[model samples]
Target: MLLAVVLASVVFSAHAQSVPKPKEFYFDEDKTTARPIVVVEGEGEAQVQALVRERDRGRRQLEATAQLAHIAFSDGRTDLGGQLYQQALAQTDAKGTLGRAVRWNYAWDLFRAGQVEPALTRWVEVASAYGSPSWAPPTLALALWRLDRKQEAVAWFGAAVRTEPAVWIDARNFASQLPDWKQEDRDTLAEVLGAWQANPPTWP
Candidate 1:
């Protein structure tokens, strides 16, 4: 998830196929699952510099810019972050795995910034991608909940526990397990978990 973002980030060479593996930059090495990479708050100094160097040289240009954008977003620099994300995405393959990861970061940032509709819209693409993360159902549920789509929200929560059988059974587990999720998101998921527990989905 360590990509760069600059307005000049799109100038790619014909030999630009050396796409970096982004997971290396998604979080600190100790993280079990990915969370927002907050550069301004004591993490990822080395990786961020690496991205800047790569961006300067136009290597994996699009992805470097996107990753930088994520850093900016994490620091609450929303407008700059969004601009960088869009610029990098202009050359992105939305159907590709790399692009999905970028979309996930951007969508979550949008969600955090209270742009639910667009966030959910981007998530629709990510959800349909091959190898979508198991953590997705709760995210979908919370987004639907925020939009007042309660039935859909609860059903998605049910879908989550049906797969893991226990992982998302209690919202309280969410804090430790999903360390990257903001508290509001966890609370929203808790609401979904409660609703699902009350009336689990029944197949028609």
Candidate 2:
């Protein structure tokens, strides 16, 4: 009887150990992908980790890919920039915000490559994206101005000013980059610069 009681206890213990318990660890649900993510320790840590991951991944996603392409453009690697932009655009759908932004990036890439006409066309599309911030119009206008489309540039600038006066600050900064900016341009830029000096952006 003692041996039988010991055997029964042993079997019960083994059974309990074999069964799986319900998960107790808390994780955030990534609704977009339905993946479980452990909470990051802090925002700074998360951002740093994300940037590290981005570099390690070689910008596998559309947004990162576009950013990489922009960097390539800045470095004067026209062929590589175009290739990356095309790859990014191909991965995104028409309705995707990433797609629209990549399109704009590609356009800027073209402009940097000295393909001005195609860049203007791409800028027009960017200007039409739903819920695009008011800051975009002035930038687009500046691009048009660079192409010497004076009337259209002026109209777009007016739209930007009416929609978001803050964009004038951006226009001023862009103008400052020109090698041969005239006195008139400098005067206009100064006015915008003064405004920005008085009220700077809270966020970079």
Tens-digit lDDT string for candidate 1 (91-171) = 767776567667777888898888887787777676655443565677778888897778878776766776666677977
Please give the CA lDDT of all the candidate structures. Answer: 0.69, 0.52
Model 2 reaches what TM-score against the true structure?
A: 0.51
Those runs of model 1 whose alpha carbons end farther than 4 Å from true positions after fitting are 1-51
Question: All predictions: root-mean-square deviation over Cα?
Answer: 12.7, 26.7
User: Residue 181 of model 1: what lDDT?
Assistant: 78
The stretch of ten residues in a row with the least summed lDDT in candidate 1 is 19-28
C-alpha root-mean-square deviation, candidate 1: 12.7
